[model samples]
Target: MRMRTKAVLLIVFLSCLAGCGSREPSAQSPQAASSSHADSGEIVLEADSLKLGQIRTAPVVVQAAPWDEFETPGRVELDPNRVSHVLMPVPGRIRQVLVRLGDAVQEGQPLLIIESPEVSAAVAAYRQAQAELRRAQSALSKAERDLSRIRDLFANRAAAQRDVWAAENEVAQAQAAVEQAKAEQEQARHRLELLGISPNEPVQQISVPAPTSGKVLEIAVAAGEFRTDTSTSLMTIADLSHVWITANVPENLIRLVQIGENVEVELAAYPGEVLRGTVRRIADTLDAETRTVKVQTELPNPSGRLRPGMFGRIRHSHGLKPVAAVPPAALVQDNEGAFVYLEKGRGRFQRRRVRAGQPRNGWAPITEGLSPGERVVVDGAILLSGK
Candidate 1:
């Protein structure tokens, strides 16, 4: 048994010795390889070089032809040409209101009937003047006949000279009376006309008619409201065929606006329907409070989709043309002025100062100090600045 145990122990010791030998080679080889790698200067330099600071690139392209640009923000207004107000020239109780707010009206169409004692009195005076004119005309005609007879008699020596002279005087007096009566009649007619009554010889009621074809925007007085004075505005009307878009353009941008320039308008109430217009008017003065110019663009309201007071936006373009520009993001505001990082060469760039014009197509026109076909650091410009 002791001999068997000794042989078995020797075999186990040899096996342990082989396993220790294998472990020594594995651990020693790895340490030697690590030390060798630590001594390699080329690899360290290559690793440092590989980290050559992150860089970004943006392609430079010439501004394409037919690039459109514009600005927005406006409000709808009444078209002055289509707007009218119906007012009572003579103060009286409104006998009836034939139209309501937003009612379409035609030229000379009766809008209301105002019952006024003053108007009636005017009519009566006009009729009395007409009667006087007729009576004076009759008297004048009779006097003329008498004058003819007297002239014949005097020629035949059958009438006295005093009688003929008296007849002539009477005829002359009648003629003067007719002239006075005609003048009075004309005065009465004018009075009636001023009161908005028809020039009919016998006027019954006054019809307040719309002076122009338009839509009534408001009716300040009701059926029984009294118009006390000329200051009272009984009704307001407007023409809806055309409308004005009042836009507040920034003062700095006012020069871009001009008469007859095309403007695109969009109303929130009518989404996606673009209304075309032209810059018809611009306020000579700027608003001190907002420091903006009031620009008015006239747009056709044919469908009547655009109503007064509807909020909208207006876009006025300076006219698109060929220009050298780049993405606005590339521009960096600096004390020296606007500038961009222009790529000088491979892995190199330099800051370039540039003058800019109004931004068009998301790019600003480089008025000076920049050219087309030059690569710029549009993105990652902030990162480059840190460097």
Candidate 2:
């Protein structure tokens, strides 16, 4: 009887074990229930996992594209039209330098005085020309009187017709000599005028004057320096009231920037200062290696603050257009690049790579990938990113 009772108890225990195995297992805990499919760029979580992570989402917005902007490296340059190089007209020793480097001078102001033999030579030549002219005029007057006498003699049959012709030829030759003398005098006078000397007064000295109103940028001559090369530059001047800002823009973006468009310039030296400029010129050819086009902008520099070779950037707008944007928390940046978490609904999210703009007004403008009205994990994005 004891044996039969033990067998019945064992069967009952076996039946209970079979029932426990057949029933459904208990649900997994929150941490264990979460899954991340990195290969598919997706993440899924259970309701408990979502609640514990405190994930929150918001809809992406449509706004003006700060991404529709253009910027390129630029530099300040001197306008070629406003620059002047002073060259002496004749070989001379600099007697006195009236202006120093960096001195502002007006047009026609004397820059230096030169004691040149050329000036004295020009004066002597002019006096000689004057004497020649006077002698030629006296000869012409005598020839005219002789021609009149010969005509009267021919009319009275006292002189041959050939003699009258000879006298007329003499008068014509005298007139030609006078004309040549006058031309020589005029040329000499012009030469003296070019040397900045009055033709009426003979002088051994000449004053070189400024060609334009500008500041002296360079001076190659001193008070006692002798310069024999007349064609070489003795000094340099430039009008600093205006300047040019040149940029090398990518070829792909060349179409977007047109001549006559307005732009803003920011210099690396002056961090916060922004100056206005206008597009003035565009190069016809592209740089083969860089695939860039040269662009120039004219900028007013009345204050003379802009200097050549200063590093800067040229910025321009492409007009307002709709662009996707999100809060700062929604964007994630890593070694790969920038990305964001998009809500796929039902506690599911996906990673989307994007091109992002600099943050502004509490939002980051999306230049690529994301679209308007899409939902993104604005809060707890870091948690999803780790997964």
Candidate 3:
């Protein structure tokens, strides 16, 4: 009887322990259910929460607006027409590099000095030619005087006619020599001018001047380097005040891109900033490999912020088309895809999946899963997305 009574008390205590374990899970079931409900794409916020989150809503509408222009990956390039290639004018040893790479220079500014014996040789030839010309002029004057004196003697029977003829022939020969000498001098002077050296002061070192005002983009030689090729470029200068944004547009869309059409450019470096430009040129032929036409847009970069080789996008407006569009603030993204919150009623919003088209001018066109006349959370959609 005592063992039976102890076993019955033990069984009753075990049952009570099991009952408490089951009640603990039942007590926590409501919290799990509430969490699952919150994640069901439905968000209900009170007036205070809406104001705190600054959530604003607007009605979706179908409107005739410029279609969102598609973007093509492009790079910022220096305008080819504005670039100046500083080439070596003569084969010589580089005496001094007056300007370094990226130096700003004005027109006719001396960029570098080169030591060349050619300039000295050219100058010496010019001076020699000048001396020969002077001597020839003196000889011609003396010959003319002798000819006149001989002719006067012959008329007075003081000299033979042959002597007079000989004097005149001598005068003609001297005149021809003077003409030849003058031609040689002119040729020598022209050579000196072509070499960018003064005929009067032919120095061993020649200074290379900048042809245009621009920033130095490249340097191919250093001081003391011997450059033997005049055809090769020594440096490159480009005007960065304006730049070209070269974009490859598809052949189908090439018609939409005309010369002088205005465009908007966006660079990754400057987010949210739209740089305005105009189409300056369009390629006559399409690229065989890319099957696209190269479109060049010119933009004024007065601040020099736009740099060469910068990656950016070019946007141009097509004609107006009817589209279901919403403000950019209404769009939100998640692991699944982009979405927007639909207003079911006051303080009630449901997450709705959407396919968004290219955004333009602060508006995004909806391609799918949204209709006109529906209210969508614009400003505060991000807050609901977090919930």
Q: Which pairs in model 3 have colliding backbones?
A: none
User: Per-residue lDDT tens digits of candidate 3, residues 1-387?
Assistant: 999999999999999999999899989999997897777756777766645457778999886666646578778999998999887777899989999888899999998898988889889999999999999999999999999999889999999989998998999999999999999999999988767898767488888999899999999889999988888988999999999999999977887778998998999989889899999999999899989999999999898989999999998877788878999878888788888999887777898999887777778888888899999988856567566
Clashing pairs in 1: 73-313, 73-314, 82-239, 83-238, 83-239
For candidate 3, the 10 contiguous residues with the lowest summed lDDT are: 47-56
Candidate 1 residue 372 C-alpha distance from true site, Å: 0.7
Residue-wise lDDT of candidate 2 within 108-160, one digit each (tens)?
99999999888988988988999999999999999999999999999999999
Candidate 2, superposed: residue stretches over 4 Å from native: 1-32, 36-61, 65-69, 270-274, 325-337, 341-351, 357-365, 373-387
* Candidate numbers, best lDDT first, in rank order: 2, 3, 1
Tell me how candidate 3 scores on lDDT.
Answer: 0.87
Which portions of model 1 show Cα errors greater than 4 Å? 1-58, 64-76, 79-82, 160-165, 186-206, 245-297, 306-321, 332-338, 345-351, 378-387
Q: How well does each candidate superpose onto the true structure, as a TM-score? A: 0.65, 0.78, 0.68
Can you write out model 1's per-residue Cα lDDT over 1-387, one digit (the tens) per residue? 999999999999999999999899888998997797565411211324432345455666567433344475888998676667677777787888999877888888888888777877888888899999999999999999999999999999999999999999999999999999999999999997777776564544577888887788888887887777867677887778889999888888888778998888889998777778988999999899999988999998777777888998887664566667888888999777898888766655677788876554577777677777888877767765754
CA lDDT of each candidate?
0.79, 0.88, 0.87
Each prediction's RMSD over C-alphas, in Å, is 13.0, 4.8, 10.1
Score candidate 1 by lDDT.
0.79
